[model samples]
Target: MESPDHILVVDDDAEIRTLLRDYLERSGLRVSAAADGRQMRAVLSRTAVDLVVLDVMLPGEDGLALCRDLRARGAAHLPVLMLTARGEETDRILGLEMGADDYLSKPFSPRELLARIKAVLRRTRALPPGREPASAAATLAFGAWRLDTVGRHLLDAAGTVVALTGAEYRLLRVLLEHPQRILSRDHLLHLTQGRDADPFDRSIDLLVSRLRRRLRDDVREPRYIKTVRNEGYVLSTAVAPQVTLRSTAPTDEPA
Candidate 1:
């Protein structure tokens, strides 16, 4: 049997913590709750957390600070879903800029939160829910970058590994798949994130910015991925698949 995804919820409100723990657990996810950053660190040290559902307004060391700390502390791979108060667009944007995978405003429905959690997990794990798996290992070579689909790693022209976060990898892969096509935020969100994007959500754009930095593409005069005026972003490079080779024993032994 597949293990349940473990989630760590950090919120100062006792009522909110209890509410989320009960609700998430009922949704078939293993949940751990922490009331503050100190408690959050303690829980993280002991458990293997798959995702963190963090409340933006904590008593001390708010969610944004904690999220940044997490990334700086080598927890970049861990997915974070921020819960901010409704109408706090600035908070939501800051959370995304701080390396959060997704965000939801407070007073949210349990069902919506559950869906967001699943979507974040799908993207973080690079699993296509309800989709067919690739027949073989696939690699995409574009410009000076080589993406190993099976290994989920990127290599530059010199063959050095280029690290990518979950969101960055997903966004880059989606762009690579649809080269030269203008992908709107909605389409990109659904394709790479496995969820519908809210109109106010700018996480996709923030993710693209991060990816661009990693690729060292100039934001003003981007060479690889370009921004379409009043439209969306597009990968202008040509992408080609690299063939995978299998090794076999020699048919005849050498004399």
Candidate 2:
């Protein structure tokens, strides 16, 4: 389990909301409850939260719509986990594509919910200001590129932003944390993959390639990311103090 952090849960089911709020609070997390998207917006406008446990179905504006709006607006860096009725694979996949950090089906165990939360927070190493491992929360910037480890957004020097898929975000995060270091696909797979490490149609290489294209990096004579031949890839550069992404495009193209 992760250390204490604020968690906002949005669900119309009063029973589920109460149970989650009570359980999360007992687990050492500050909890906030919202009945729907509107309520969630209200809460978000006033307070800050580390993660969001969003229910897929809401009374008026549905959770998926809310997720899209949140991602497009400014919460792109904020991690969102969706809840749905069990056996809803379509919703699960759609949620992932929409940039949700994770999801849970109904009839889920509280223990599982807690475990997922811990995993994400651990991988991200999120912490508030004035916390332990001071550098862990530090933001890294390379030219116009900014990686806010805490806020979880990548900002360009021009103040534009590019939204990253959850998996891509996690994979890039691991790479950035170890700049100038060559991490093989296997090692990266192990760090980013789920439990059991099931050997499925999985690998971070394709994602890396896509990421390189977005960074406008030359694969042959790369600037930001360098290929290590049969070994892996290395990012060679020092991150500036802060780089603000435009929040306009996912990543800016070379002008």
Candidate 3:
């Protein structure tokens, strides 16, 4: 039988750590907790963790720094879900830009955190054993960018590869799927994050900004993904399918 998905909870708060460990373990997940980055590294060195539930506020080597280090240490493939007490948009954006797959504010329900963790893992295709894997979508090409749905890779016009986080990739894929159609933040959040937007959650906008920066799309005059101003955002470029699937129907583009 396949082992359960393991999670590492990194937080300096003993209460929160204990609460998470107990809650997550009771939910049939294997969880390990670390009070700080040093302990986190120690746990990571000896264990195969599927995901990290990181608290943004720590005594030393804050969660942002640790998350940045994790990405730098070639652990970008590991999904990270950030927990923060700040609840500020800037802090959330910083966490996402630092490679966190999702963020949850403080005083949150344990149920919601569990849901967020599952969503992040699902989006990253890191489900536990006995679960069916999601099928890859078709490869999409627009302007100078090529998205390989099979490999979940994004290649630039110059043939160089662009690294995108799970959220960013999902947002870009949804935008590509509905070219020229303005997708509101609520719709984008539902489609990509598999969750509804909280009144305080600005994760969708932050993710869009990060994707824009990665694609080198000018915010003032984006060439591909355009902001529709008070409506939503749209992918303004035509996409060509690089992979052929007989089951798919051709899309008609308006002249």
| 2 against 3, candidate with superior lDDT | 3
Runs in model 2 deviating more than 4 A are: 1-3, 126-167, 175-189, 193-255
- Candidate 1 has an lDDT of 0.83
lDDT of 3 by residue, 95-189 (tens): 98898888888889999999988988887773221122233256689999998664455899787877666667778888888998999989998
Ranking by lDDT: 1, 3, 2
CA RMSD per model (angstroms): 6.4, 7.5, 7.1
How well is each residue in 12-107 modelled by candidate 1, as lDDT tens digits?
A: 999888888899999899999999999999999988999999999998899999998988776767899999999999998889888888888889
**Each model's TM-score, in the order given?**
0.84, 0.63, 0.84
User: Per-residue CA lDDT of candidate 2, range 1-255, in tens?
Assistant: 764688899999999999998998898889999999889999988987888898898999888889888877756557788897887777776676566766778989888998988777665443332342433446677745876654455667686766565566677677777877888767776676443323432235566775676577778777887778878677777655543333432334311
Q: Cα deviation of 182 in candidate 1 (Å)? A: 2.0
Question: Who wins the lDDT comparison?
Answer: 1
Which is better, 2 or 3, measured by TM-score? Answer: 3
Q: Candidate 3: TM-score?
A: 0.84
The candidate with the higher TM-score, 1 or 2, is 1
Each model's lDDT comes to 0.83, 0.72, 0.81
